[model samples]
Structures are given as C-alpha cells and as structure tokens.
Target chain A: MAAAASSSDWPGRYHHIDQILDKPGPRTDPGFLAGDGVKDFLRGQAKILVIGAGGLGCEILANLALTGFKDIHVIDMDTIDISNLNRQFLFRQKDVGKPKATVAAEFIMKRVPGVTVTPYFGKIQDKDEEYYMQFNLVICGLDSVEARRWINATLVNMVDPEVPESLKPLIDGGTEGFKGQARVILPGITSCYECSLDMLNKQTQFPICTIANTPRLPEHCIEWASVLEWPRVFADKKLDNDDPDDIDWLYKTALNRAREFKIEGVTWSLTQGVVKNIIPAIASTNAIIAAACCNEAFKIATSSAAFLNNYFMLIGTDGVYSYTFEHEKRQECPVCGGEALDLAISPELTLEQLIETLTERQDIQIKKPSLSTPTKQLYLQAPPQLEQATRPNLEKKVSELVPPSGEVTVTASTLPFSLSLRIAYTS
Target chain B: MKKNEDAAAKKKPKTSAAQIRVQKDLTELDLPATMKTNFPDPADLLNFTLTITPDEGMYKGGAFTFSFAINTNYPHDPPKVKCTQTIYHPNVDLEGNVCLNILREDWKPVLNLNSVMVGLQYLFLEPNPDDPLNKEAALEMTKNRDQFLNNVKSTMRGGYFKSVQYDNVLAR
Candidate 1:
C-alpha cells in the first residue's frame, strides 16, 4: 500500500484504493517504502501543524517530506526574500516576491508528489484553534518565547487535555546567534512546556532575554545580509548598455566596498542605504536543528522513546551537543501541580477568575521571596552541587507553598551567585 | 583549484531570492577592506565563503572561515550560516553553528550582511553563556568561569576540546 502511493507512477496508476498493490517499477525511489518504515510508529493517521517557514521550518518541511509524512499543515505569513537564501534552501531567485507557502508547496510537489501541503499565510491567531485541533502533534519552530508560551498553553487545552502518557510534544530549534536547544514536553508523563517555562521564567528570566534581548546583542563577527534588486541597481549605475563581460574586478571591488560603508549614530534615516550582511552558516544550523527535531519526533512517533522528556538538547558550533535532562521530582509539583489534566484546560481564563479565586481564596497566594536563578548575582559563587542537587527539593518545597495553579518565585543565596525558583499552579 | 572552479561552475544564475538579496547586500555592504567574499560560483551565490581576520578580541590572532548558504528567497528570509572554523565560545556550536538572533526571529529584511559579521566577531571577545548554543558550555561558563576560559584557550591553540583534536586548523 505504501509503495503504490509513493511510486513515480503511483499518482497516475493508483486512481482507486483497490489498485494499491498492482503497480510495479521496483517502486522507483521507493519513497512510500520510506514512510512504510515508520508507519506503525504513528498513532493512527496523525495530523501535524508546523508554525513557521523561516530557517527551522524550511528544514523541518523538507525532512518531513523526505520522511514521507502525508498530512502536514504549515503556517507562515512571510514572503521569500534575498536574506533568507543563507539558510532556507527550498526556494530560488525566481521564487522571490512569491508566497513562501505556495513556493514551498510547489517544491514539495515536485520532490515528493503524494503528500498534501496546506499553507496558512497569516499571523496565527487565537481563532486558528479550530484548525489546530485537527493535529495530534504540534511542532513549534517559532523564534519567540512569548509565542512559545502562548502555543504551550493553547495546544495543551486544544490538542490533548490529558497530555497523553505515550505522546511527547517536541520543540526543536535554535535562536539568532549560535545558541540552539530542543526540549520534549510530555504532558502527563513529564513536565509540560508551561511548567518548564514557569520554572525557567521565575528563576532565570529566560523569557525576557529571548524576547527583548535583541538590542543587547553585540554585532556578530559575521553580519546579517540584505536583498539584491537587479536591473534597477544595474540600470541606475548606467551599466545596462555596458558589456556584461567587461565588468571590471578592481572597479567593482571599489564600488562593492563603497556599498559596505556606513555612518554610525546618524539618525535612523541617515543609515537607510547601508545593507546588513547575514552569515549563511548560522542559517544552516536551522536545517541541522530541524533534522534533529524530525528525527526525535519520528522516534517518539514510532517507538516508546525515552531520554527526551523535559530535557534540553544543547548544541554548539564546534559540533558539541549534549542532552541535559531535568525531571520534575514531585508527585504534586507546586509548579506543575502533578501534571493534572485541568492544567491543560482552556486559555480562556480571565483576570477576574484568577484574582477572585487566587487572591481571595485561602489556598492561594503569590509567593515572591526573590528571584534567585542560577544566573542571579546572589547565586554566582555557590557550588554547582549545592544548587543542582537542591533544585528538586526547592521546587517541591515551593510548589507546596503556592496554591494549585498559582505561581511563585524564590531566591536564596549570597551575592554573585544565588539560586532562584519559580512555580506555577499546574495541578 | 579545480574543485573551486567546479563549485563555481555549478553556481546557477542568482535567480533565487536569496542570491539577489546577497548581491544587494554585497552591493550596499559596508566592510573594511580586510573583509572579503569568495564566490566559488557566481551562479551559486547562496553558498559562499567569508574570510575575516579580527582586529579585536581573543580571536584577534586568528583568521576564521565561514560558509554562508542563502535560501532561494533572499531579503525576506534569514540566511543559514555556519562557522567553517572551530572557535571555542559559548555561543558557537562545535559543528560550527552560531547563536545570532537577527538571523532568526529578530530578522528584518532591512538588516544586511555587516550586521551579522559584526555579531559573529563580537562572539569572539565575549561569549554570552546566559544565552548559549552549548548549554554545557554556558553552564560551565556560568558555573566554572576559569575552566571555561581555559578550555577556550586550549582550543584556540589548536589543541583539543574534550578528547577531540583540532590541530590542523588554518592560520589567517
């Protein structure tokens, strides 16, 4: 059946489901046979929702397509640009100015004919929940922590409230610089993304850094690049009539170098024509990270996998990558609240419900001692074992203090190196 | 040289949006003459090499090689960049992956090549362990600052990271 669907002629020959087995040609590239390898790994015919078409999404789409995933939906409100060429390999110059989804779908159709690619070209809204319900697995390839936090809360309620014992939610990706990390959120079986986010947020301030950290970035030794518009730039230079072969290297060098000049601190308008140079290599990391994501997702989809839930897959440029696992130690965590089903319910809770239920109730109260994350000035000098070993204990202790589904932040250590803990009422 | 020629020959016309954007970036690029672009193929503008000899930072003594692979769609998209050279820093992965955000979500078409190059260079002087590509490195940098510094020192001298030897690295 898989072979009939994947053969080059499979599209033409197998018009009906009954004609699945009779087709021949050694299945040519035997693409469906590839899918057949892991068909049993999937929990029924699962629908997949991809959230971006940038560097990570491009690689994820290609890897998934090559892996023979048939029912896949991608959402990205972006157009193809010259800057993307550094990492996104799916489109070409001819494809510039076109919708990324449309071109991406066409590319897939040419490369792998059987799979269906639906493109949602717009900002993903709360109303998009109806479309999100169709998928069993949600792969987040976005670059924003706010978006990530929102998706975590929303998907839990929409996709599977129970946070299936067997299923794992995988967030595989890297950020602007060289930092790349992946984590697996197993709803009921392990700590969900929200629990991790709450913990990470209260303790380390990972959210604000990932969101507002841009201006803080020092320039890369390499640079971000800009797009090139031909015929115009050329004609403007009065080169349209010049012999193409006569383009002088020395003269071109001076002209090109001139393009690199910029006036710093000039009002924003003064720097208008200056182009940014983007490093293509960092763009490639998106592909590598995406491949790793698909590989892990495939493993979870096919086998009863281990070693992934609530762990960080950290990658380095020198090819150094490691998986650091952090498991929730409490049966009823103050942060995660025992991975309770109610924790995954509806992103519709209002401020009134939260304030009346949380503030007025005896069971609830915000516990804010002081944020003492590992990076905090207070926790700088403490022994690694002191903080690392005490994390679970601290989490349990704090979770017990906060109300069910309420949040808390704790800081206790000396100056330079203090440890902090943040707990959310997930139970 | 022949391989260079072949790579160059395989370069298709810069029709991909990425190539066009790169070309535009190059045309308007603002770099010291010390920086240069090597197009193994004028046709394959997306995949090219960059050479930078930093005048500042721990990487000041060294010359680094980087490979840039642009997506078919140029300006609107972020380019995939990799460090061809192995540098010991919290942000750069051992496999040559960098941790720059402008190339990721913060990316705007308005950003050009100089921004990324400067960002990559800044990594050499001060690696941000808090926002790390290698969490262990970040952890170690945060937890064991001296040792992290030592590891970086040894690696740059063309020694080993963990047990892997990176002795054949090229000089700038």
Candidate 2:
C-alpha cells in the first residue's frame, strides 16, 4: 500500500507510462507502432469489453483502468461468494451475492474518476451482435471452454475484412491454480480461437458399457444416471441439475443402483462434482495471467509494443516458465478461412453415416446438417415439408447421392459458418 | 376443506432445471471407502452429511464430519460445504468453511460432490500450505513442519493448538 501511494496519486499516476513512451529523435524509418501520441491514443475513447468478473476479471478491470483506458464494459452473470474474497481484491464481505459485473463497475468508477464502466449483469449470449460491434477490443477472462468457443465463434462471424473497424481483436486469458495463458486473437488476420483445435484437449469420456454394466468410479455412476436412468424414468421430464427434486430423484436412484452393486461411498455432493467437472483456481495465477492480458491489451490499443504474435503460454508450477510464439493459421479454418473442406469418405457410407461423422469431428460441429449437390437438393433439415422430402436421403447410399468423388455444400441452422466438402471415396 | 384440497392439487411445485441435472448427477455418484454419506431426510437432496475416517496423514485415525447444502441451481452453481467438526488445519477455517477450489471459484457445472470429497480427503492426507484460509495454521505448517504435526495431533486429542480449542476427532 505504501509503494502504491506514489502511483496512487493523480500527479504520479502516469509515471509508469514513461516506459512505453516512444523516443523523439527518429533515425531513418518509423512504423505504425513508433513515434509520439501513443499516450493520447491510449487515453482516447477506445472502448474495451472484459468477459467474466471472477478472479481474472477483477484484476483485468483494475489493470485496464490504470493503463489509461477510458471506456470499459464488463459482463458477468455471477454473483460474489465468500471464497472469492481470498483473491478478488475489489470486493468486500458486504458485496457477497451482489451482481459481479455491476459491483465491479461501480467500484472502478468510484476508485478511478473519468473512467465510465458500464456493466452488463448477464450472459454474453444475452447480448445481440450489434451490441458487441461497438467495442474496440474484447478481453476475456472466462473459465469455461464452451463460453470461450461461443465468444470466439461470435467474434469470427462478426469479422468483415471490408470494414476495418469490425476487426475486433479478442485478447483472452485463462488461469487454473498455477498455470495460465494469454493469447491475442485477430479475427480475420491472424489465427482465430477456432483455428487451433489441437490446443484444447479432448474432454474425458467413459465407455457406455463401463458406465452401465460395470461402474467402478463415482464418475461412471454419475454418467449412468445422466445417460441412462434420466431418460428411463424421467423421459417426459428433462433433467436439470439445478432442480432439487430432479437431483433428489437421481440421487435416490443412483444410491439404489450403488447399493445393488455393493459399491460404497456415494453422496449427493459427489454427484454434483462429477456432473459439473469443476477445476482448481488460486489468486496468484489469476493475478499473473490477468496482468499479461492487460499488458497485451495496452500494447495492442496504443501500439506501444508489438502485441503477442498469437499465444503466450505460462506454467507457474515447479518454477515460472513462459514462452511466446505465433500459432499458424489453418488454411481450411471453418470459422475464419472460407474454403472447400477435404474429406475422405467411403462410397458405401450412407448420408446418415456421413452426417454422423461430420457432427463428431473435433474441428467442425454441425447439428441437424443438410447436404446438397449442384444438380439435386439431397437433404434438408428445416421446414416440415422439406424434412419429409429429405427423409428418403438417409437410407440412400453416398455414391448414389452424388458422384463417388465429388463435392457438396452443407448447411445447418446452428453453424455460424457453412462448409463445402470435397469428398474422395476410399472404398 | 374441499376447496383447500383443490387449491393444493392445482398449485403443484414447479420443478427447476437444476433439480433435473442434480437428479441425473445423484444417481451416478462414486465415493471412497473411507467416507460415508447420510441424508437427514430422504426427500431433501440439497442437504446431506459426510463422515470421513482417514487411515493416513497428520489427522490419521481421526474422524471428521462435514455438512453439504446444494442450492436450487446445483450444477451451474457450487454447493456450500462446511466442516461440522472443529479442527486445526490449514484448509478448513475456524468457522467450518473449507478451502477447497471445487467448492468455490473453480466450480463448474461438470464437477460433482464425489470430486469435492476426494479433494477434501486430500487436504487431510497432504494439507496445502501454499493457499491457506487460516494464516496462523498455514504459518505453523510451512514454517515449522514438525511443530505443525504435533499441534494437529494435540488438537485432534481435544486440546488447544494456538489457544483456540478443537474437538477430539480421534476415534474413542
């Protein structure tokens, strides 16, 4: 607190900005990042949106405000909890159960005058496309991969190369205990979030046989409850974990199953953890990760320093190790790069099989997909009339649908980007 | 009486989305051999108790109990877990709020009660001094490892560790 007193004052506030201030005496050539007015550019009306108001979000907001940004918007659907006080520095005991976004914004506005932070106390999906377009940049401190992917897909879809202003750079940060990473995502120019599917590890899944016939771990029992018993008993009632009655039914049923198998140690809390897939988090990692993200944001906004090429990987375990490298763009990136996707399929495979295969692919996911060739509209997923017409295509062989090794366009209501598949029949 | 009965039948308790997920999750729980679960009432899925008798660690041969309360928004939100037994440990604070990540900020829709129990069990086996909810206990564990062990054993035997009284967790 004593050391921060120097920078805490208005007069000594911009002292840290000296490090990034460009040199006056230019030698030969200057780039976009070079020269004066860097300070003015940062202090300019550049609007930034920060996703998540948890550990990382709390630090990112304070960093952005201290880094000379004027207009900031934060969106989070969570309220403060008692455990958050350990790391979430901005909040107090009284603020528990309060909307994180609203409380965070009000705190910042009170602390840092001249900074107007509008907080959205809702999910990112709640807002329309137009609402996101207003921001100069979007910084995400989100914990979930699903939320990250949604935000990534939304940003990629929103990118129009023709409109320079529409190019929203999504700077993302994630922290788990001692490990964290920050990445700079240039929607159309550099690799988008969807470009690198390999970076995200496959979600752990147990075999259906293991979960059903022989359940060893608690996770297996939970999976059985989710995959089998839920549908068997509560077919009419869609399972929602938030509901106490639904949970109660599942718990009793699972307990009965566990008792029948003579398995020990099944609890209601255990069921919740298995279903939720919770991870570990700490304050130091959140602080370190958020700082990296804010640093990248400052560089990107003011061009004070060259922004992270693509990814900045960090590991705080054992010892702190960090490296920055440019992640290459995939030529056939579904979200960003629009081109024909090459697929190797068997001629004997039916449209149903191919649709199943495409849906399961790691890079691309399409639910209720439709296929069409140049000459014929092979299948359609929408409209009662069209679905009835395409019902025959499911049984039709792949070779019969189109030439053995030809191309077809795929369309789906859920997909943000359509695909043109160039198929090569193997058998 | 007839009118009241009709009103009761008409106003059925609306089931929540979280309850459905919780119901699904509860049927699949896999807990450890050392621990057992007890529900005060079979109808109440949200509140339950967990009893653990660790075979190994500083709190060895000691019994510990914890109470869990799941909110209506079970999967999306984490359940509140508290230690029923007062003990000297770095993770579990004096007020019974345990310092487990899954029980707090690390919580997600995919995590279940089983994972939380394992985590809590691990705390007894190898308490983390790095992230401490109790500063005094953390200092003892990190600064003086031997003294910390002694303090834990003494406290478990129904004595004071740092002038703060703890219940006898040892199996009598």
Candidate 3:
C-alpha cells in the first residue's frame, strides 16, 4: 500500500502531499500514525464517519473525499427534498425522495475516484458502539441539539483510560441561516458538547399563561392548539406532528383564535414553525461551517496544521466575520468528568418512588430508569425476568437493596447524558 | 446519465409545509399593483420571479426583477434570493446578493413571500443608508444626498456610477 502511494495508482489529486509527509503533528504516539508516513497513513487507512447528510454533511463529504481520506461512512435518516437544491450542491433534483446519506455517498463515490463511501440510511441511535469505534474520527453536520448530545455522550463513553490510541476526535458544525459555529472536541481533552451545553441558548419556551389565556403572537395560538385544543378535541388520540391533517387542524384552530384576538400575521408556515420549532438555515452558512469543520478534521487527521483550539463562530450577515477561541470543559460534566454525584434521599423511599422523584427533577429527567449498585444489579425497569426479580426491590425501601451510601450507575435512553449517583440515605 | 431520474423527479406530487403555505399565501396575496410574481413552471414550486416597479422613491418608475429559490425545508430555512438585474443600489449588490436582514438573520417562519416583498418595497421607498450592501451608494447618500439621488437617476437610465455600469431599469 505504501508502494501504491508512489505509483500511477496513486490519486493525482493528492500530488501536493509529498511536502507534508515528514511533518509530524502534536500527537507523538507511533501507534497513532498508520503503516509508514503521514501521506500513506492518511491516504491508506484513516476511517472517517460523517453524521447527517443534509446541508453541512454534503459539503463535508466532498471536502473529506478530496482531502485524501480513504474510507468514509455517512449516516442520515433524511430524504432529499426539492428545497435542498440551493446549497447542498451534491444531490440533483432527480435525487429527491432518496435517503440523504445514500445519495450523498453515491454522489461522492462517483465524483471522487479511489475513495470508498459507505452510506447508512438510518438513525444514529440504531448504530452500535462497535460501528463508531471503527472510525478514526467523527464529524457531525446534524441539526438537532438532542442528536448532538447523544453522539457526544456516546463518543465520550468510548474513551478508555488505558488506551491512548482509542481516543476519538469529534468535529461538530451547526448553522442557523447567516450564523454558524464549528468546534473541535477531543474527548477528555477539549470541551465536549455537553461541557458547553449552556452556550446553547435555552430553547424558546412559551409561558402557559400566554399560550392559554392571552394568545397574542401566532406562536402562542399554535401552542394553544397543540397544548390545549389537541387534548380537548381528541382525548384518546395523540397529535402526530408529521401528519398534514394534524397540522391543518392546528392551523385552522390557531387562525380562528388569532382572528378573535385581532392578531395579524398568522399563517400555516408560522403555525408549522411554531409547532416544530424550526430554525432558519442558509446554504451559504452551512457551506462555510462545513468547510471549517472539515478543515479541523483534515488537520487532526494529517497534522497538516493545528486543529481548532476548541470553537469557531462564523457570522455571514453584513459582509462576513468569524472568531475562534477555546471553550473550557466543565469539571462536573456527567459524561467525561468527576465521580458519581452525591444524592441525599430518605431510606423509606421506594425504588419506584425514587424513579418518580427523578422524573420530576429537571436535571435528571429519566421517565424510566434502571439502577445498579457497584457489584450487583439492584433494579431494572425492563425485561420480564429482570423486572420480576427487581419488582420487590421497587416496592421495598431504597436502603434495603442499594445500601445507605454507595455509587450506582443509572442507564436510560431518554437521558441527554448518563448518570452515576452516590446514594447518601437519610433517616 | 441521471436524466431519466431527473425527468421523473419533475413529477412528484407531494406538497410540503412551505408549498401548502405558499399556496395559501398567494391566494391571500395583498401586494400593491406595482409588484408582481410569476411562476414559469407550475410543476416546480420552489423557484419564482418577482418584478417590482417602485411608484415612488429614489428609484421610482423603475422596474426591478428578483428571483426567489425556496427550499422544501422552507420556513425552517430562508429562501435564496437574487436581484437578477444589474443595478446600483445600497441594499442589493452587483451580483444580486441582497443584504436584507429579513432575507437573512431577521427571517422567521412567520414571515413569508409577502413579508419579503414588503421589505423590498420598503427598501425602495426609503433605502436604508445605515446598513448598506453597496457601500459606495451608502457613502454617497451620507456625504452628498443630491449626488446620491443623481446617481440613482443615472442607474435607472442605464448609465455608469463609480465605474459600475447598470442596466436600464426604467419601463420602455
């Protein structure tokens, strides 16, 4: 394969890499460098994974493919739409109705020869740890904050203290129209996404009073339809936001409310936007952010340059501007930092009661929880055998099974990050 | 090679949230007679053209055309807009990349094509000399208001200002 790096088989596109093969990056471990030199290492074996083949994903795939990455995998659950034509630049109108990951992979494979592009047209959660562990690095072009948090925790959990070679670098990019940000996250090194969770503005939440009693804005009226009207009209049914009928019903109901209140500018788009909480995205912003993210990924992979210290914010409105600075990691971050949190709970509280109590708490919003002590499984919320074996424990006092004070690791899919709690029982 | 698929793609019947909203918005279209929108291809709802003739303002009696490209992900994402004409204006550039805040950062799902149209109309009635896309036009307006008005007149008359040639925009 090293011979292939020199022969006619070598991709002519990477002709400029000969100058940088001797240059070493900040990483010193010989194990981190593949086979022989940097060129052979980057062009021969580096495995890269891209999450979300939407706006940023398309650009990242192209950038990585042309940047000398050998093997790449893209995962996205979205389908191509007519609207993606302006900025995605990969998929043509003919590619509509196809999975984004599949189409993006196909498009890249055809355009960039010698590079293998694998596509996963499924949810990120569906992929297991073994799958992600194969990748040298992960680049996220995702739109959802929850999805990013899940990937961040998953990558952080994969970092083994004994194995320095097992470290996985995550480069994340996000955009809202003219504004965008890209950041480098070296798990247990730089600030993980959760470490900078507060940096994300708290998602806009409509007050119940404004939504119910005084519906002034179109958003307020939409909230009223979903939060109040849905329950009142269809007591037995759950409102499916994806359903056009459900949206139409909300639009009509909200518009009627708006008319009564003499509020202007109540439209179907606004109703849909309010219900789904859509963020305005721009193709240009996605392109800019993706380029920065891929630049960091390429630098991290080849050591061509130093990676971003931590974060870079790009603003494209009014000419253009960008700023880069390191965002510090929090010491108490549940995923990568500190020991189990110490919790004081009454010994008389049952396991089910504790679960209920945790659900009510904003910090630990696990509607269903499975708890285990340091040695044995104390209680599980699922599986017939485990549920039956732990059924009595749920009814019994917390002190009887978990003891007064010890560390317990809690697992739940709903949680943004995993929890390890030290139970300090009270009288 | 993908022509067959592309032709087939031109046949999808799915109506997205933006499409539904665009339909509703057009039916309720309350634009002044000076502005008009055209959909050359009924099958393709994402792209369209809007022509505006400013009845009054610095560029009054001049007709300007702008193109809008709305993504299926519309409402969540702002539409791609271009001036389509070469003009000397403080808000729109030579390449047609307009610098309207509503078309960029200030855009919301609540705002539609009508809102964008209104914004463009307002741009003519009173071109924002504060936040300008063409800085030269902005500077001219700030330093010498009469020269700026004369420059606008020249731009509409197919003349050159600051060495930037503009296409004649006045109605024949």
Highest DockQ, which number? 1
Number of backbone collisions per candidate: 130, 38, 2
Model 2, residue A262: displacement in angstroms?
A: 5.7
Task: Give per-model TM-scores.
Answer: 0.41, 0.55, 0.58
Q: lDDT per residue, candidate 1, A1-427, as tens digits?
A: 4454444444343233213222323422333332334452231265677777878888888877666466677877778977667677888988887877777777776777677778877766533444555665667687655566555544443333333422436454654445566666654446655454323311111221232222221121001111122221342443321233323322343243333543123222111222212233376566657876776665455442333555655456567666667756333222233221122222333322322333343433322112221111111112222223233433233333333333222222111111112223333
lDDT (Cα, tens digit) per residue for candidate 2, span B72-91:
54554577788887888887
- Give the share of true interchain contacts found in each model: 0.01, 0.00, 0.00
lDDT of 2 by residue, A185-229 (tens): 988788877666446643466644455556777666776787567
- Candidate 1 yields a Cα-based lDDT of 0.50
Off by over 4 Å in 3: A3-12, A16-36, A317-319, A340-407, A410-427, B1-172
Q: Write model 3 residue lDDT over A256-300, tens digit each, in one string.
A: 998998888878888877787777778778888998998888778
True contacts kept of 2: 0.00
- Candidate number of the best TM-score: 3
- What would the per-residue lDDT of candidate 1 be over residues B47-152, giving only the tens digit for each residue? 7777776666555666677788776434445576777766666676566667777766566555667787777666766778877765667788899888887676
* lDDT of candidate 1 at residue A351, scale 0 to 100: 27
lDDT of 2 at A258: 83
| DockQ of candidate model 2 | 0.01
